[model samples]
Target chain A: MYVSMRKLIQLATVAFATLVAGASLAADKGLTFGMLMVGPYNDHGWSQSHYEGGQYVEKKMPGSKMIYIDKVNPADRPGLTIPMVVDDLVEKGATVIVGNSDDMKDGMREAAQMHPDIKFIHISGDDVLTGKAPANLSNLMGRMVYGKMMSGYVAALSSKTGKIGYLGPLINEETRRLAVASYLGARYAWTEVLKKPLADLKFQVSWIGFWFNIPGVTADPTQVARNFFDTGYDVVLSGIDTVEATTVAEQMRKEGADVYSVPQDYIGSCETAPASCLGVPYYNWGPDYVKLFSAMQTGNWKPTWTWSGPDWTDINNPDSSAIGFVKGSALNAENAASLDQFIQGLGDGSISLFSGPLNLQDGSVYLKAGETASDKQIWYLEQLLEGMDGASK
Target chain B: MRMQGLKRHLFEIGLILGMVVLFTTLLLSLVGASPLEAFSHLFAGSLGSWAKFSRVLNVWIPLTLCSIGLLYAFRTGLWNIGVEGQVVMGAIGATAVLRLGLEASHPLFYLLAALLMGMAFAALWALFAGWLKVRGGVHEIFAGLGLNFVAMGFVLWVIFGPWKRDGIASMSGTQPFPLELWFPSLPGWRVSPFALGLTLAIILLTAWVLYRSRIGLNLDAVGRNPRAVRLFGLSPSRYMLLAIMVSGALAGLAGGLQVTGIYHRLIPSISSGYGYLGLLVVMLANFRLAPVPFIALFFAALNVGSIQLPMMMQLDSSLAGVIQGACVLSALLVFGLRTLRKRGPSDE
Candidate 1:
């Protein structure tokens, strides 16, 4: 028995040595892009949108392949850092890597410094703007504020109750700005469009602490949505990355409650509960990904922060738009017509909700009369607007 | 007689290995993957180059430390399931010190101080569990498990509250420490040499303390028969507390290294489940110290290599965890069979 065990060990050692030699002999042959996703690729929300964008890249560019690892967050893949995965991807001959999470800012920066030759695209980061990123790294995000505004517009148009709830993710500049944008749209629809008294409308925001639920880590979105519905908030605009708002709305409607939801992120999010979904403000990353990858391939890529907005000529044009909203089955004909008019006004610059006499949640002056918010002001919004309820910091 | 004992040991090991391979291969085939290709990918992904091997070493370092720590607690017959909480407290303590030294000079001094504070914190946490067991008569397992939840809650609160970034309340953790505060490594190396040296020193010290000293004998006696140990003028409770504190110190050191060496910030999961993995490693080593490091290296390699499964084969990386579970189950089965054979069916 002892002799056989010794022989077995020797044989295993030789096999492993040969395998190592074989691995080194293999070489890269094509343009490979590596994608790291914070959630599962099939999650039908944030990560899936990025995964589909990678798939779009493969179809558009010949001889290019995508290698992706999803669920890249610390909770799901503990002990796996961005640099470690980047090392593996580089070994596999990837020239471009996309990290699809704001949580990856530090690790992506570290990995970008480690591999200056490889180009890195970190979505929803300000590293490039902040001058903290290396020259090889860039940032990309859709102007989702417009989409969220449209989402709020539709929700306010279709609601029977004037109370609207915003189911928010963690408190950050990005989420804060988005939530505020939704509130602006809802307020516009409630007062100017519907001719309702300003005191009759109620808007509140509830944050669940993270991008998505991790069981015990984040508050369950389903429960939060149910609370919104049970409390006479007839419409809930989801600022999270999942379809839990629509799903809960559908469950509530079945029990004879009239509630509507607008899910965020991927276009197909409403398919989970189409009857209750008012619309989805989704990201169309394909066109931007193709443009960026083409620039990288032609060696004309300069690291820049790109916050692309939807094509005004056709917001839902899959071939052109970076951000788009799709109306769900629940939107009534009159509300849908009004929503189209609202979109037209936004596209033509005839309406600007950010112009005011605006006060922050603390009643401090945010914008004076006839004063408009600049891009920086909108991007770094410090508090929820007056008449909104939620934690700001 | 010595030759027969060695042969039996070899036979038991072979049986365990064979069972693990068979079970894993069956799982691969069931998933419609070629077993040979999967095995090769796992091996090549982990050991294909120096860079990859260094990553495996990075995982092995902490895992081995925790396993060695577990050895001390096990010697005194304490479950010490609270090792996970101890690791978190250690990370919290290390981060507290590192945060203070963010702008301080002589980063090396701060780094050393952080490690010692981490150890002190973890030792105190472990001592609480020991106290509950020795004085309050609460089972260490329950005390440890409950404390683990509290530790988790505390880390979450720290990340989302006081340590949050300027305007960000995120689970991504505090802003990273400066590069100077990071555990120094060579230009091309992924693992810090200082961490490697410290781990090696700890292993040697543990071996001496657990095998070559009078304290080792007393702890072993306490484990086997605490009442008898008291008759020998040795306080079993004292030895139990001492063993648990030492275990906590080592686990804490692992957490400290994870911060200064690996993560550079206090992420919510800074411990990376290494504490539980250590429990498995020590158990699979059959409560012995000799095989602990080897088993830890194997587990670490599996962890590092499993990344290849997702990238190359579109297979779930959890297969590595499944393989690990199979190995431990197979070891338990082999040991059970050996005991059954020794008793010649009369025990049944």
Candidate 2:
């Protein structure tokens, strides 16, 4: 037994040596980028997709290197942080720093200040100086409402009971406004197309004050999904990590319920609940990243709070959204034909998701008769719409 | 210390066991967990999955190093809690160096800088406590704990102040170091060869020092009875100071390596309570350095596995903490019970 162990050790050492040698041979043009995640890279939500986007960048830019750090707490945003892990990136020669979370304000700022030559780009951020490019730092975000509208389309199309549920994480401006766009689309489909009363189109909404599942105390989304399905809501539309929504649909199917699901993070959830899942409004953050970096390389970079969102289209368009809506297989041929026409109409400016005269669940006037909410009004949503079951408070 | 040394073998085992159980109950009461379920949760979390096992190891590597360093305190009877602060300092030191441009050299530079700076920072932190103990009337425990808070504050300040990034203005953090500077990943795991080496090296070194040196004997004497050291012509006060410093230094080394080799930067959320956890390891080991690695790893697994509870059991991670407290308390209970039995039987 001892002899076998020795032999095994020897073999392992040789293999390790060979692996190192192979890696060394393959090490060429080793450019590195930094990805800061607020949660574990494995978290199947926002963090996971961002991580995958980093992988996508690596696959596209063969010689470039990508490094990710997860679970970066807020207090670590400043300098004394033993957890910030930014200095390590600077040490590793990262030419471009990708700050993934909103809280990385301090850590990345210090890094950019200290290393002025390195290009710094912030996503889902608001601090980048507009018009005047500061040699190195820039910020990028996208029109989330555009994608939410597409999700709204799915929600509108899928509601059999004429009642749709919107599960939101952290009821902030981003979510509130997005929810409104989604509601408008659903209302448009139910009222204008199907001629159903706006009152019949119930929008059940709830806020969990978090991005992902927190062990206890908060509502377990899967349980909530099951409860929703058990209570007769058939088509579940998810505005958060679509994984939980799809998982719930899968459970319903197992229990023999005819449930259909639409999830975000378009690709994976579709695969997980293909039969029930309609494609989610998925974002492709990579193209923007590439654009930012290429502009940086050419010394012609501008820093602005840029919001890129266009009509639902193919992946390769310049102004194309980071999010894409996957067409559902369950969408009937008649509905599918209509959905396609609506999709085109959305892009060409004929069909508006928010054709007003809208009312909140409480019968409060949201948009008076002959009034459609403009872009500015949509961007700053304050309260929950009518027919929503949960407290917006 | 053989089991046979006790006049009654089963009696001693039972006593130690009884203490452990009682202590476990105490821990449960502190956190309001059903004592029985907590231990079960802990056990399940530790042995659950490959992912959980990996998390424990990740936790263990740094914690074991800290505890092994802390053995120096037990040697001289100094209850040093400053290892936590010292670690933050070392990690900060390593981060500062890496940030400044130390990463451009071979990975060895970053590794070496982290190790040396970590030890230096810990030693400095310890020396501060030693200075206080030697100068003021302050006890080593208070001084050590004070240092921990100060060091944590310092870490927070850096991440938020000078280390702040120009991003979302949210509390996220700076991006991680470049891949080249990262301690290479073990296939299918988060383990770093550098962390593994440091943990093992500290373990071996601590064991060797404690088991094979004249200094070790001096430390043992100081611990058992400080007055005895004076009788043996050794300065007890001096030894106390040295022990605290060594303990602090070890914690610093852990902190340094954790940043440079593991997390790869000085983030504000770095400590993860390894210093306090080290106390549990030392206590669980009965102050024996050699067994500390195993115990720390076990507890680390418990923590990592608890994160899984959310994924699998839909349970909270705090449940894991509840279990850990129970295990410690129960073991202590068993210890107390055995001692009670020995004394009572004689009285009866």
TM-score of chain A as modeled in candidate 1: 0.91
The superposed Cα distance between candidate 1 and the true structure at residue B269, in angstroms, equals 1.4
> What are the per-model DockQ values?
0.49, 0.06
Question: Per-residue lDDT for B1-348 in model 1, tens only?
Answer: 867865777687788889999999999999999889988989998999989999999999989988998899999999999999899999999999999998898899999999999999999999999999999999999999999999989999999999998988777788899999999999889999999998888888878888999989889999999999888899999999999999999889899999999999998888899999999889767787888998899889988888888889988757767887898899889988987888895643
* Model 1 lDDT tens row, A33-53: 999998888887899899898
Which residue pairs show collisions in model 1? Answer: none
* Top model number, TM-score: 1
**Candidate 2: tens digits of C-alpha lDDT, residues A1-393:** 999999999999999999997876564346578777666665555667677777777776668777665554422121123222454455456677887765454455655665677777776655663333355667766666666666666667767887677766545556676677677777777877788787887777755444555433235778777777877777666766436877888767777878877776434547666567665666667767766665665567666566766545653242445755566665667766776676677778788656566676467887887787875566555665775665543
Residue A202 accuracy (lDDT) in model 2: 77
Give per-residue lDDT, candidate 1, residue B314: 87
TM-score of chain B of each: 0.95, 0.83
